[model samples]
Target: MPSQIHTTEAGFELTEDQNCMSELVKLCTDRPELVLFSRPRDYYWEDVSAGEFLAEVYALAKGLVANGVEPGDRVALLSNTRYEWQLVDFAIWAAGAVTVPIYPSSSPHQIEWILEDSGATFAFVEDAHNFADLRAFLLREDGTPPLSGSASRLRRVAVFNEGGIDEVTREGEGVEQSLIDARVAAITHADIASIVYTSGTTGRPKGVALSHGNWMYQTRALVTNPIGAVARPGKRVVTFLPLAHVLQRAVAVALTIHGATQAHWADTSTIALELQRAKPHVVLGVPRVFEKVRNAAYNKAADGSGVGKRVFLEAERAAIAYSKALDKEEGPSFALRMAHRVYDRLVYRKLRDAVGGVAQYGITGGSAMSPELSHFFRGLGLPVYEGYGLTETAAAACVNHKGGQRIGTVGRPVNSYEVRTNDNGEIEFRGPGVFGFYWNNPEATAEAKHDGWFNTGDLGEVDSDGYVRITGRKKDLIVTAGGKNVSPGPLEEIIRQDPLISNALVVGDGKPFVGLLVTLDADELSRWKEARGIPASTSLEELAHNADLRAEVQDTVNLANATVSHAEAIKKFRILNRDLSEQDDEMTPTLKVKRNVVFRRFADDIEALYSR
Candidate 1:
């Protein structure tokens, strides 16, 4: 038997005295004038220098100290991804407190649970509306306000829209700067930096406790390594992903360390407009964002004239072929090169221009992207690097980056992480980036970790070259009544590539045959209805049963079926009226489906596939 373990040496390490706050402090001292961040104004963006940001952070830290916040206290931040979020986060750290982030979209029950679980006392929210909602939920039955240091220990709630930063700034003015300095000096690499909760795909969310050394080590390695070359001083980055996500937060920390000019964009609906305006050098997104961009381009091409559509189809084929050819010993042929060059001008250029026209490349995670789609993007002179990691790994343990890229695989271990496969083929990792434990959940932590290695629960394979290819979730395996096991991830990835399909959830555990539940893309469906001359007023529920829509979905299912064995193939499918959404509690903040939730919510629908 061959060895299953793959290990990469550590690229960087942290000093004993260094903490997450050290880099910002160093930047302010070394390059006070460097523009560290830019926040959007009414029309243009206003830049903030390193010195200015540090000053504000200190002032906020003083305020935190004045507000009865003690060292090691957990301060909860509930808001969207914006400048204030970063401000409060650093302020909490500077005050020698731990930051606990709650998703802005979280429900009242979730907010209560997280606050109670994390033992947070001070909270910052985004606006008046959110504050009002929070107040309403946390009020006592006797009508007393919860802000009086109630049962949950949450004493105060500040709203950004209500001049919360200014209020805090004013409160700390009388406080001495030496107090802030002393607290900063007291913090070390061993102290906890933040407690980020998991997405809670199954069961309740567990808080992943990451120490300052974990971040300092991981971020230093990221910048010093070849993969993070783009994170140098003066590089512009537009951060739109929620900071509550460990991946986005880690990237933000990495960028801040290198003096990159960061811009915060919270509204996903206007992300394209923001991206175009920022013209960032590197982009970071989830697989869904990239998928939407690809689907949009495909839909546009299809909606054009017949000649144009044919040209696009031919261009796509040429792009994928050219990308694949680059991997071979002999490069792309002269004919293919010529064809690619032509398409680069005709089709690829427009796609690139759609995303700011300046993005060198993109980094995507959260889910696996099909090899075909990855190739198509690379063929357009824009490679989308895919990384694989969990909340436990602090973002990326394996990544396909600049010089070390492999198209289909998430590249070798990063940040000195070691990867291995057990006899059952489940992925395991040990690295500086990995969190030490789950906050107040020792049982869960014990279950997830063995010795120094973290059990990832994800199944994968490691090639001779050390590249890691994720096969599927070990817990998500669907075993049929006949005992044939199938992984739904690959089939779902293929089916979702269809322009009209937004999501595909495969079902058939202990069933006779595989079945599927699919949801249509709202934007694509509207265009499809228009192109086919369907009534504009038709609702999704009405269209779900349409013969034309069903036939189109069946075609995608057929394509998926062709890739797998007969036992694993999807024999039937049902199109849902609406897309799976976070609001419905069917999806996590990271856009991963809550399988148990979906199974319960649509039990009848799932059973209907087999019953008929």
Candidate 2:
């Protein structure tokens, strides 16, 4: 297939009632006995059938309607990933309202901003901490906080961990179930399904208004594709990514539409334990999750004896070679195959056990994954298919599907989308999956759209086989004084691959040559110290100036520089005493580095690199 516009063949046509609630109704009716959700109770996993799931949604939808929720009303769900989040999301749709997801990590000001901006009438928070934060914002000044032009709209708040759903169900005692059905029936494809707010990297978040048709088209296109068929009936998925993000939200909807079972983890920290219990077939995650797993595996192997370490290294090399042969459609050598089989028993099986021992495929997104990590996973028999999209395009625009995947690129444009790059290298597309508009931001929406195409604000190219490779953010491109446009993202990805490095910021925009500011991974640094017999009492500042550590970082920089042209390569660099983190306002919720913030915070170090 060529890299140009590609569309799906017939027989995969979209349905008439493609709204989310209607699809849920059809799915429940078709597979009432099928287990849709496996939620963890006190000590055991509790299965919720399609029929039971719909029943709960009906009750919650009735509660919402009884509480004065009208069609098109904005309902906020501020919680972590749990079964309740999914229930509230569908319940909001069932009541003919739009769901507004709020990241639980948001500060009080951020929570207030989203609530006021969306004009949400009701909010569901996870626990007492979140409820307290929202209450503080609600009652900021003399029991009446100043809302940003949308205060009067919000009426009630519910806490999910404290019997809130039961209270809501009791409140709807007089409201008939038929009323909820009527609300669902009245919904059309054009109706707004959600107003998902973006995790603003530069400024305040913007709400991307996605219609029912938008999600329906993307969901159908995804579930019906040959690659998507991997998430078929009886397939189990372990989801730990935040539901607030569009990618995970789309995955949840797809699971429901395809009758796949989902097991939710309380947070990322519990993923390994949950995976062991669930033994999921499909895994959905961001790049950071895979990175952490890879790091853990590396650390484990390094902690072993010298002979064990050498054996592990040899096994990894054989696995990589075998994986490459598979990618090239060439058979592995007899010796290499035998070596890999032995390693499979020694090392590969243990790696698989870490991820529940049954993960056939993993879908990663939200950021660019290093090619090294992608190949490493594939070599372990767990191929991770990376996809690309934004909040505006309903999560996935292009993806690596089964049987026709390119390792480095994010595969072809999905069946519902037509993607092309402009003269300026900005990727643009127009498809059914495209969102309707930016909620309450007409000017911003207009600026983002030209003609019928939505500019993705990402720089990339499509290969001959239709695989798209993202180079960098158009806005984050660093043009040097020599007039060379350097993509810092690729360099940063390479630098982060070093176990000692945590995060990296590539600078030198308008400067003589490329420079970088790097931070050390605290855990990896400790491990390195222990291996070298260094005291644990060494401060981060002391380690930053250590001659041995500096030399290792220098090697990492050299490795990264080898990949780019001389003009775009790092000429000078400094290692920071501390790492960038979300709590420090140096990273977005999705772990993307906030370059401007980092630069401003470390102006002295950045200036010093250029001063010399």
TM-score of 1: 0.96
> Highest TM-score among the candidates is held by which one?
1
Best by lDDT: 1
Candidate 2 matches the true fold with a TM-score of 0.95
Candidates in order, TM-scores: namely: 0.96, 0.95
Q: Write the per-residue lDDT of candidate 1 for residues 1-612, one digit (tens) a residue.
A: 323678655456567878768678988889999998999777888999999999999999999899889999999998999999998999998999999999987877787778878988788999987786567435465645556544476667889989998998899898898888888889877788999888867888889998887788767756654337678777898999999998888889888867888999988888888888888888899988888888778878877877877888899889999999999999999999999989999999988887889889998889898888899989888899998888888878888888778988887888678898876788898877789999999999999998888999989899987899999999999999999999999999999888888899999999999999999888888888998899889998788889988999998898889989988999889877678999888888778899999999889889989997
lDDT of each: 0.86, 0.83
Model 1 error, position 567 (Å): 0.5
